[model samples]
Structure formats: C-alpha cells, structure tokens
Target chain A: MRGHFNYLRPDCVTECLDMLDQYGNETAILAGGTDVMISLRTGVKKPRIILDISRLPETRQVEPYGETVRVGSTLTYSELIDHPVIRQEFPALCAAMGCVGSLQIRNVGTLGGNIANSSPAADSIPPMMLRDAEIIIQKKGSSRIQKLEKLIVGAYSNTLEPNELITGIILTKIKKGYRESYQRIGRRKSLSIARINAAILGRLNDSGVIEDARISVGSVAPSPMRMTNVESHLKGRKPELKTILEASRMIAQEIIDLVGVRHSTEYKQPAIAGLALKCLEDVFLDSSVN
Target chain B: MNLEIDFCLNGSEIRLSIKPWETALDVLRNQSGLTGVKEGCGIGECGACTIIIDGKAVNSCLILAAQLDGRKVETVEGLEVDGKMHFIQQAFLDKGAVQCGFCTPGMLMSAKALLDKVENPSTDKIVEAMTGNLCRCAGYVQILEAVREATCMKAPLNKDDVTNS
Candidate 1:
C-alpha cells in the first residue's frame, strides 16, 4: 500500500484489453480483488496501474457453448455454484468451489482469480482439470486458447503475458456414464486451505467396469496435476471396495514419486490415500449401489 | 492518485475522492463516519468488515474504494428506517445476542443478507450464512436464537425505541 498507483475501471472487455495493451507489465488486472488487494497491501506486488476488469460484461457471462459450458473469468464462486449448467453437469466443480473460503469470500472471489493466483492449495483447480478445462487468453486484438494444465506451469506461476487477460474457462460437459466426487482435508472445516484434496471422475460401463478414469490431486506437488498413472491403473477395473483401495494407494505412491519424501510425508501419504479412496467411493461405490 | 467514486452508501448516494489504496472499510469508517463496520483483520479471513454490496455480504477490507463505483452498499447502519430498529436488531437485543458487541454489526449484516434471500431459512442455511462472522465472546447460541426470532417476528418493536446510537 505504500506505493502510489492509478486505478482504471473499464466498462467493457475491449476497453479493458486496450488498457492492458497500453500499460503492459506496469498494470495488473484486478478481478474480484480478493488476492490482488492482499498482495497490494503487503507490498508483494507493486504495479503502477491496476486495470479493474471485475465488472466487464463480456467477462461475466455463464452459458453453454455447443457441447461445453463456458464460465466467464470474473464469474464469482457464488455465481458458479448457482449456475444451472454448472450444478447439473459439473457437481465435482461445484463441490470444490463450495470448499473455498467462507460465504463472504465466495461472494467476491472469482474462479479466474483463483486460477491466476495459481495456489497449489486452490480448491478449484483439481476439479477444473478433471473436466478438461481450457482457458481463453485475450490480448488487445487477438485471443488464444490453452489447456488449463498447460496454462499453469508451477506453483504461483503461469504462462500468461503481462498484457494478456483470461477471458473465460471452457469445460466439457459431463456425460451420462460419468460419476464424479471432490474431497478435501483442511485443518478446519471452513476458511482453511486444503492440506490434501482429490477430484475423481470415472465413467462406468453397463457392467460397472471403469471405462475411463480421471483423477487430480492438489497440495501434493508443486501444482495440481492429473494422476495419469493411477487413472491407467483404475481403467477397465471394477470399482469395488478392494479395487478402489488399491487405486487409492497408487495415487499416494504417485505423489511420493512426483514430490519425493518431505517432512510432512508420513501424515500426507496416508491422508492422500484416504482422501482419494473416499472420493472414488463417493462417486463409484455410493452412487452405483443407491 | 485520487479518484472520485459515486456509490450508494446506506440508502444515500454519495461521492468521495479517495486514494486508490484506501479500502472500503477505511472509507466507511474514516471518511463516511460509519463505525458500525469494524476491522478485526485487515485480511479477508475475519468477517468483522462485512458489508452488503449489491445484496451480497462481502468483506469490506478486501474491496478497494475505487471498486465501489456505481454500486449499492448496505451496512448495519442502514438496518433501521425512520428512527425504528430493524426487526433483526430488536431480536438481537431481546435475545441478548450481544456480549462484547464487536461482532454484532457484521453478524447482523450476514443475517440480513440471508433473510433477504430466504424468507425462512433452514437451520443449516442459517449456520452456513453465519459461518463467516466469528464472535469471540462465544455467544453463538443466543445469536442463532436471535436470527430465528427475527425470522418469526410479527412486527417491529417501536418507532422510537431504537436510535442510530
């Protein structure tokens, strides 16, 4: 808060994109202001100009596009939770968003802000990855799309340019055979960052055999990543209790191999396994039996 | 850099020239003279700075004054109309929900936001809405009772019983 900065509020997305082009690295896009305000007050980020794009109409739309649902970058967590398309097709994403801060925080925090902040403990990223989410990045005149996994390179880092803005996120609709669950372990029930979280989406065939499995875990590595190895192990297998327990163990082992042993490994190893098992069971075992 | 922001604060349209670094909490408390909004934590973790912005309860500490452009902001000060206490305030007083009284303003705002959306919220809905506001005095039982009481009230207490004090 020590530095003096000019604030610009653009009413439309094109005007905001023009401001970003004019200022480049000297400007920071302010969406939701949940993360940017804290960084500004703590002197962690000092930009000469702040382009407030939270109110841009083009970046606030939540609608269906062909076979996928598109969420505007400025759409808040509350909006996402209440959107009909999101509630019906992406329950895992809804569950992940519900675990974010408190009601007050959710009222102002946006999914794009959560993605751009790129916290490894971000509750939304794991489920977003499960849906094969893609980010649409916009510059002044042109825009490009990139897979969500590729957009985020590491912890608190992404490939976005200084003059670029995230317009929206595209998530493929969950089909009929797919079952999903999101589970997280936090220090407390509310307003705590996740210690370990998992998002599982599996497609079951007529005989209850796994046709496809997609699993993603957060806070276990430098970034939230899809567990392809575990997914491969679970595919074509029955989602019985024993099979899920073994697949859960594989998820834990995958984390160890990726992040290696750390001081909190003893607790996290079992916790990750248990969380993954719970998510899988919630989606596959519980739903199928009912 | 000073910027002029025009917004509706507690049913009044006001314009203020404030520094871009000033938060909504600072503007409300220092400039607007609305001390009902407290700042327990400068960060967004605590809901002591809760205010209703466009019918949503948000932490004022996390919102910059510049972001209030053309928006409607309601605080605990706006709860009463024509010198009469809002039913929620009356219920809080009757139920003895205030102990230290630090978190009451924020708690009232959160409760009002919930009631505005749902005429009769379930117990789970009430708890979820009130989770953000933390009362260190451990008066949650009475606070819950006050919200429930406010939901069932037939009429306001009196026209002159409660003032802006």
Candidate 2:
C-alpha cells in the first residue's frame, strides 16, 4: 500500500518465479486474493510487490497427467467441480469443495491458495490429504515437491519459502476398489467455515477386507492430520460396523492425544467420531459392491 | 508505476490506470460511476458488494481491479434495459423484497447471474447462487420468493409491463 511496486501480470510461470526471487518476502504471490487482500488490508502481510500470478496460464489447467492427477494452483473450485477427472477420481475433494462457501467463493478460491494458506479449517485439506496429494513448489530456478501433510506443519503455517510459488498439486490415483467420503460439521447449511471435518479413503479387497486405510481430520488440530494408528489397526481387517465403530474410537483417541481435551473437546471429540464412523460406513457398506 | 486494466463495464469497454490496492468495487463505483455496487464489508463477507465477474458472480470488494484484466464485470446498473425494469427487478418490486435497498442491487445481480446460467434452476441451485450475497434485512424469505418469481418470468419485463399487472 505504500510503495509503487510493479504489478507483474506474468503470462507464464517463469516470470512469476523470477519476481518472487527478486522480491523474496517483500513480494507476495496473488492467487484468488481472497485471503491475501484481508492480509494486505490489515497489515498482517504487507508485501512490497503483488505478483499477480492469478492470470498465469499454467496455473489454470486441471487435467490428467498420466497416473497422477495434477491440479493447477489457480483452478477455482467451480472449475474443479466441472473437471471430469476430479469428479470421477476424487469425489471427497469435490465434496469438500462443495462445502467451501458458495458457488461464487468457489469460483474465485484456488486450491493452491487453500493448501498454501494452510488454514486448519480449509475444507479441501482433509480430502486432499486422504488422497495423499503432493504439492509442487517452484522458485526462480529450482523446484521441489513435498507431501501436503509435511508442507502444512501448523495452523496458518507451511514449509513454503518466501521466494517459492506453488504451481500445482499432484494427487495419486487409488485403485478401483478404493472408496472414499468427506463430511463436515458447520453452524449453518451454507456459507459457513467448518468446525470439524473428516475425510476417509479405504481400499477393500474382494473378500470385504480393508487392505489399506487413510483418514484425515481437519479443524481439530493445529493442522489436518492423518490417523496413522487407527489406519494401521484397520489394515486387512473387515471394516464392518464393529470394526468401524472401534476404529472411530481409536481416531478420536489419536486426535485427543494431539489436540488435547480443550473446551470444544467435549463436543468435538464425539462429533469427529460420529463423522468418521459415518464416512467409513458409507465406503464399507456400499450397495455397489458385489 | 501505472497499471492499465481493460474490461467491459455495464456493457461498455473501459481502460483505466489503477493502483495496486484498488478493488473491483472501487473501479465500478468510482471510475465507472455505477455506484449501485456498494461495499458492505470490504472483505467479501457481506453480499452488499456482489458483482458478476466474467460469467460468474463474486464479491466485488474481494477482487482487485488489476485482476479484471480481461474479464467482463456486470453491476446492478446493468440489470435495466433501456431505462426499463428487468424481470428480476420487477419480481423484487412485486414481491416487496426491496426494504432498505442497500442489499437490493447485489441481491438482484446475484439472482440475475444465477437465472442466466440456469433457465429453470432448482431450489438448491438458486440457494447456492445467492448464498454469497447476504441481506441483513433478514427478509430472505421475500428475497427467495422474488428470485423464484424472476426465474419463472422467463422473459425480461418492461416498464409499461409493470402497471398493467
């Protein structure tokens, strides 16, 4: 707001990275700017230069890249919902995207911005984590990819460097037997940020045995976390009502250990358990299965 | 340094030198003289400042003017045709949805964008489209009814078309 910094509407990724390197912390990559504008206005983040990367062509593409699906940082939720690959391959992400405000907010909000901002309540995190998504970050000349769980270390915190710009996200495809679900608890039906959310993806064998399981919890901890212990316990076990209910309890226990029994714990711990059980129930007890 | 943004405003092309801090609402209400776009929260929460960007609706306060480099922005003023009331406007007036009128423009624009994409949208689609724009009047029931009436009208309503009804 103070300095007359050049507004670089870079048409390409290289130009944007160049600006980021030259400016470092003094520069900020402007995606949807839904969060950036709030930061800028409140002086929480006063970047000397606003790198308008929202217009970059590379950040708008969301197509299949071989076995892995790549989502551009600039692709809004509306675009994501329309993308055939996203709708088919990552239904949980699509469901989470649906819970992100209204159609208008989804039209402008970007997946890259969502992951980069690392908001604990970010609706997309749990779903993307369930997919075991990897984030692609690029600087002036170097590029690095990290699992999203590692990228988002804490609330409103991430491993991204000042000169780094998140270009795309890579989500690995699960097998045909894989079933997933995403659920959230909010105050109202619409336009509400989630209080607690859960995403569950489990691979079941022909014999109705859980081959592998991954569950991600959001808005309960400093960051969205994967339930490793519960997942391990449910491995190769038939995820029936009994197993799912017990696994749900284990998930609640793990979350309690991490987030501690805060004031909301009395409400949240039980709420998250019910959500996890429901998600597992849908996937494990699908009528489509032969 | 100066930045030039070229976009269609109220169905006309515009080119202006905008600051880095300027918002779409700032450009619409200030430079374009379409003051119908009001800034309620300045941060995208309140629907009082909603506008159509490209083909989708968004909070004008949340979008920077520099972001509208090659997009079409339609404001509430664009709702009228030849100084006549648009169908959505007539529906609002008919339903008595206009209370303080502060939220009327945004609500109308949001409704127009929704019905434009969906000729006969379901209740869910209508609710989804207008969800981002908030009306403090808590007259949401009337607003919802007005939007439904506009959607059912099917055609644009004229000024003379109002009194005959």
Candidate 3:
C-alpha cells in the first residue's frame, strides 16, 4: 500500500518466471485473488508488482501423467470439481472443494492458491494429503517436487521462495476398493471456515477387514497432519463400530497431545472425535449399509 | 499508475484506466456508475459485489480491475432487456423476494449464472448457487421461491440471451 505497484499479466509460464526472477523480492503472485485481494486490502502484503499468473495455460492443464494425475495449479476449485477424473476418482477432494467458501468462491479459488495461502484450516490440504499429493514448484531456471506436507511449515506459512511458483500438483490415483470421505465441522453449513475437518481413506479386504487406511485432519495443529497413529491402528482391524469409535478417540487424544490444552480444547476435543467418527463411518460403513 | 484495460461489460466493449489496487467492484461502481455492484464486505465474505465474469459468478470485490481485461462481465444492471424486466427479475417481483433490496442484485446474478448453465436446476443446485449471497433480512424462502418460479416461467430464459456479449 505504500508504493505504486505495477500489474503485469504474463502470457506464459516462462514469461511469468522471468518477471518473478527479476522482481522476485518485490512481487506478489495473484492466482484467484480470493486470498491475495484480502491481503492487499488489509495491508498484510504490499508488493511493488502484482504478478497475474491466473491465466497461464501451463498452470491450467489437467493431464494424466502415467499413473498419477497432474492438476494445473491455477485450476479453480469449480473447474477441478467438474473434471470427470476428479468426480469419479477423488470424491473426498470433491467434497472438500465443495465445502470451501461457496459457489462464488469455488468459481475462482484455486487449489494452488489454497496451498500457497497455507491456512491451517484449508480444507483442500487434508484431502490432498490423503492422496499423497506432491507439488511441482518452478522458478526461472529449475524446478523441484516436494511433498505437500513438507511444503507447509506452519499456520499460514509455507516454504515457497519469492521467485518460486507452484505449477502443478500431482496426486496418486487411488486403486480399486479404496473408499474416501471428507468430514468437516464448521460454525455454519455455508460460507464458514472449517473449525475441525478430516479426510479418511480406507479399504476393506475381501474378508471385510480394514486392509489400508489413511487419515488426515485439519485445523487442529499448526497445519493439517496425517493421523499416522490412528491410521496404523485401523490397518488389519475389522471395520466395526467399536473399532471405529476407539480409533476416533485415538485421533482426538493425539491432537490434544500435539496441540496441548487450550480454551477451545473442551469443544474441539469432542468435535474432532465426532468428525473422525463420521469420516471413518462414511468411508467404511455408508456404502455397505445403503 | 493507471493501467488501460478493455473488456465486455453488459454486452458492450468498455475501456478504462484502472490502478493496480483497484478492484472490479470499485471500478464498476465508481468509474462505470454500476451501483448494482455493491461493496458490503471489502473481503469476499459478502456476495454483495457478485458479478459474472466469463460465464461464472465471482466476488467482484476479490477481482482486480486489471483481471477484467479481455473478459466478459455481467451485473444486475444488465438483467433488463429493452427496459423490460428479465424473467428472473419478474419472478423475484412476483414472489415478493425484495425486502431490503441490497442483496437482491447479488442473488439475482447468482441465479442468472446458474440458470445460464442449467436450464432447470434442482432445488439442491439452487441452494448451492445462492448460498454465497447473504440476505440479512432473512428473505431466503421468498428468494428460493423466486428462483423456482423463474425456472418454471414460460419465458424462454436461454443462455444466449443472458450471455449477450
């Protein structure tokens, strides 16, 4: 807000990278503007150059790369949800994206923007984490791939350098028999940020035993974390009500131990457990029961 | 520095010089005199500044004026054709959905965006589309009724008419 800023819209990724390399220290990349616009108004980020990379074709492609899918970083939530691959293969991600903001927000909010903003409560991260997502970060000359969990250091913080831009997110495809669910508890049903949310992916063997499980919960710690402890407990166990309830309790306890006690702990503890129960139940029970 | 941008607004090509920090909402209401684009929450929380860009509804408050270049934008001011109320506007009137009138424009634009894509959207789809626009007067039931009526209206509210640009 202090200095006069230049709004530059680069036509391609290379041009964007070139501009970023030159003005890396004094630029703010604009993707969807859902988060960047808010920061600009609050004076949280004052940059000499507002780099508009929202329209680059290189960052908007959703192509299948062998076994995994590479989602262009700038693809909006609405666009991603509409893709047939996402709707058929990643229902948990679809639900998470649907839960974000609303239709208006989803129309413009990008998966890359959500990750770049690095909010602790970002709904997309938990689901992306469930799929073992990796980001492709590119600068002027070189690029690197990093795990999504490693990229986000803390609440609203990330390891992205000034010149680095997230170009694409690669998510492993779920094989046959895997069921996934995303559960969120917010202050309201619409346009509310997630207070506590979770994504659970589980698979049952032919014998009806939990063969594999992955759990990631958001808005509980510094960033959304994989509940490796609870996920390990669920593996090889019968997907029974008692087991689900016990696993849910373990997740609650794990978060409490990780975050320590706080004024909101009394509410968040039970809420987190309840969301876990719902997500687990959704993954393991809903289809069979129906 | 003021940057020159050209885009289609309400079926007409418009050229404007906008600053880097100027939002689409600010440019629409202040420079273009499109008061229908209201500014409720400077943030994206309130959908009062909702507008359709390139056939999708978005918070104009969150979009920079420079982003509007080479894009098609539609607002409530464009809902009337030949000075006649659009079918959606007629439905709102018949359903008595107007209470305070502040949120109506946003709601109508949201409805138009949905109807532009889906001819007769389901009830769940209607709720999903309009959830971003908040009516503090609690005029939701009537608003929903208006959208439902708009879908059932005999008037041919096709996509071509709404996407006039």
Candidate 4:
C-alpha cells in the first residue's frame, strides 16, 4: 500500500484480459472495492496495478442461458435484488444479497467480489451454493469454469490465479416444488458480520417426504461449505420436527468433526444447530417450528 | 501515478488528476473542495461518506476516484439550489433530525437516493436505505421522521430544481 500502483480501467473484456495477461501477479482486480479498498489502506495487498473491472460491459450483464442464468461478475447486489428474474426465480439468493450490507454497500458490492474475496462470513455464498453456482473465469486466451465451493479455499483466500478474472457466476434455476431459505445469526441486523449462516433448499414429494435437499452453511468453517451428510440424511425423510431437530444437530456435529473443538465450539455448536433448524423449518415446514 | 478522471459532480462535468490509491471520498473532499462528504470509518462499515453514484447511494470511501469516471456523482451540496435547501433538508429542519450533524449529510443523501427512486417509500424501505448511515447522536428517530415527512412533501423535486436553478 505504500508504493504507487497504476490504475487501469478496460472497457472491454479483451483489453481487460490482455492487461491481466501481462500484469497479472502485479495487479489487483477491483470489482466493488468494498473489501479491496480496506486491504489497500492496511497494506494487506500492494499491487503494481489496480485493475478496475467494474465497468467492463462483458461482466455487467445478467443473461439467461437455457435452464441456467449467467450473472455478470461485477453486477452489484442492489441490481440483483431488483432484478425481476432473480426476484421471481431465486428469492433465496436475493434475500442473501439483501442481507449483505446496507443499501449503500449493496449498491456497490458485487457477487464476484464476494466470492473472490472469499470471506467465510459472506452471506451470498450460502444461498448461491444452494443453486450450485459455477464461476466463469478467464485470462487472455483461455477460460475455465470452477464450482463455487472449489474456488474459495479458506477465509479471505481463493484459488484464483492472478491472471484469472471471474467473468460471471452461472447458477441453475430452482425448479418447481423446491423451497429455499437462508438463515443467518448475526450480532445485529444491519452491517453485522454473520456469526453463522445456513441456506437450505428442499423439495417435498406428494406424500410430504423430502425428495431432494441441499444445505450449505457459512461462517463456522474456513469457507462456506455444503453439508452433504445432512443433505443426504434429509432426503426421503418426513421433514417432521423430530427429523429436522436431528438433522440440525447433525449440522453442528459435522462442523465439529471438520473443524474439531475450538474456543467458540461450545457457543457455535448450538448456534449453528439453531440456525440450521430455522432454515430447515423454513424450507420444509414453511413456518416456524416453534 | 496520476490519472485524469472525468465525471459529473453535482450536475457539473469536471475532471481531476487523482492518484491511483485516492478514493472518491478523498477526491470529493480534497480536490473538489466538497467537505460535506464525511469519513467516519474509512472502511465500508460506516456510511458517513455516502454519495449517489449513477442514481444509487454508495459509500464513496469504498469507491476509488477513478471508478467515478463517466458516472454522475451527487453529494449533499447537490441538494441545495440558489442557497435554498431541498425539501428533504427542509424536512430535516422541520423534524429536528440534526443533533451533532456529523451524520446529516450522509443521512440526507441516503434519503434523497431513496426518494429519487421510490415515489413513496414505506417505513421499512426508509430503514433499509438509512441503515448504512449511523447517527452517533442517537437521532435516528428524528431522522426517520424527517425522511418520512420528506416523502409527504413535493415528492423530491431537487433534481429538476437543481437543473432549473
């Protein structure tokens, strides 16, 4: 942060990729700068070039491709919250984005930035993981798609190369009968970093049995992760209060097993379970289990 | 490295040579001489540096000055025309929303941004819009009242008023 860096704003994707190709390692890709600006000030990230890709036309659109929708990397949270298709189709994702920051932060913060920054407490990740998000990344000549869960490695870390630019996040549309819910435990409602958050997408068959389930939890782990065991347990279950209670406890147990006992484990164990219970009830019971 | 960034500020087209690290908050307060944009928390946590960019309220401190290039920027100064306070400002006075006044400019800009978009915002909408801006004086009740009152008055004529004036 002490040294001076060149500011580069490329209007098109080709130019952006070319710039990244040459000055990848020495450059910091700035999408919203909600996270990067702080790092720049604190000397956490000192790059030779500050690449401003917020205005690239290629990464500023939301286009539908068959059953999936491609959300541009730089599209702000406010834009996603107001989008008709996102609102109607992906209400859980919309709610997660709405819980990000206040209106001001939402107006500028982007989903791509959230994933790239890869904060464990990012609210958007849980809900996006519910839809099975895939990130489209590109450099100069070639591009590759990575699953959202695979991209983020740990807290504030990602596997993305310096030359790689996240172009868009493609998410599958939630089909009929699927009920998705995002629940978070924060210190306060506004501008509070989520202590523990969970997103559950469940579909019940005609006989009131859970046919499919997807559960992703955040803030408790190094990165937001899917509870595959809990999801598998939920499938074909009756989604009754007893089943949900057991599944919620399993979520905490799963985390305890992965992260092992920590200083906050006693508090976070029940907290994460309670959060998962709320999300599960929202998805399965469609009302408060209490 | 310094770069010339062009953007519309408070209805006027201007350009300035800004360093790469300088934020929009820095450019607005230092280069443009608009001290109204306050910086409470340099991070995005506090909304004291809130400003409207391309019709959306954003934390100016979180935005690089170069990001404002080719975008329309609005600050508290834009709310006044010919020394007459905008209706939103008038509502603040009528409702006594200002206490210590450090968070007033940010609050006013957040309110203006909301009123500009939604014709008649509900209480929840106002709360959502102003949640970013923290009034340390605990003047939120009065501020919310002022924004509510502003919604009842002329329906945000400041944009046109600024142009006409």
Deviation of model 4 at A240, angstroms: 1.0
Supply every candidate's count of residue pairs whose N, Cα or C atoms clash at under 3 angstroms: 0, 0, 0, 0
What C-alpha lDDT values do all the predictions have?
0.90, 0.85, 0.92, 0.91
- Candidate 1 residue-wise lDDT, A90-184, digit = tens: 99999999998899999999999999999999999999998889999999999999999999999999999998999999999998778899999
Give the poorly placed runs of model 2, Cα more than 4 Å off.
A1-6, A287-290, B155-165
Candidate 4 docking: what grade?
medium
Q: What is candidate 2's local distance difference test score?
A: 0.85
Please, what is the TM-score per model? 0.96, 0.94, 0.97, 0.96
- Name the weakest run of 10 consecutive residues (lDDT summed) in model 1 chain A: A1-10
* iRMS (Å) per candidate: 1.2, 2.5, 2.0, 1.4
Q: What is the DockQ of candidate 1?
A: 0.69
**Which candidate would rank higher by TM-score, 2 or 4?**
4
* CAPRI verdict (incorrect, acceptable, medium, high) for model 2: medium
Pick the winner on TM-score between candidates 1 and 3: 3
Clashing pairs in 3: none
**Cα lDDT tens digits for candidate 2, A68-126:** 89889999988889899889999999999999877667888899999988999999999
- DockQ leader: 4
Better of 2 and 4 by lDDT: 4
What is candidate 3's CA lDDT for residue A81?
95
